[model samples]
Target: MDISDKATEREEQDRDIALHQRKPEGPAATGQCLYCEDPLPPGKRWCCTACRDDWEFIQK
Candidate 1:
């Protein structure tokens, strides 16, 4: 393809990557893990990284 077309394709790819990496909005923490309902400290959504990753996976 032409240089301009290639540039446009790259831009679209970058946009796609950014969108995929963006986190989806979730409910506010309520003193529990969003995934496992385990107790959590204030301002925390997940009990651990594994829980967070699983939660995000299920969200998709």
Candidate 2:
């Protein structure tokens, strides 16, 4: 690819990474696991490893 093409590709990759890391926000942001309905800790997002895996699969 050309230099400009490579730069565009990198930008797209960075956007994808940022989207993956972004979590839900707002009044709807309940303190619950992303995959399971279980409650999460103060700053937690997943209840267990399995739930995390399932959430990732769904995200994909």
Candidate 3:
């Protein structure tokens, strides 16, 4: 299309990429502990060190 349309499309693509990159990956993204499946506090990935250790073990 036009140059203006190309610029808008590029902006939209950049926004989508940023949003995707900011999203958490793996079980942590679901707001539960990666191992125990317990509810997590805001910005927490695991409920405790045990769960965190379990996740680390599984990843290896």
Best by TM-score: 1
Q: Candidate 2, residues 1-60: lDDT per residue as tens digits? A: 499999999999999999976876422335898777799776577888898788778876
Better of 1 and 2 by TM-score: 1
lDDT of 3 by residue, 1-60 (tens): 499999999999999989966845554446788788898776677888888888988988
The local lDDT score (0 to 100) that residue 38 gets in candidate 3 is 96
RMSD, each candidate, Å? 6.8, 6.9, 6.8
Tens digits of per-residue lDDT for model 1 on 6-45? 9999999999999966668878878999999999999788
TM-score of each: 0.56, 0.48, 0.49
Q: Which pairs of residues clash in candidate 2, taking residues 3 or more apart in a chain or in different chains?
A: none
lDDT, each prediction: 0.91, 0.76, 0.80
Worst 10 residues of 3 by lDDT: 21-30
After TM-score superposition, the amount by which residue 13's alpha carbon in candidate 3 deviates from its true location, in angstroms, is: 36
Q: Model 1 segments beyond 4 Å from truth?
A: 1-24
* True-vs-predicted CA distance for residue 30, candidate 2, Å: 3.8
- Candidate 1 vs candidate 3: the TM-score winner is 1
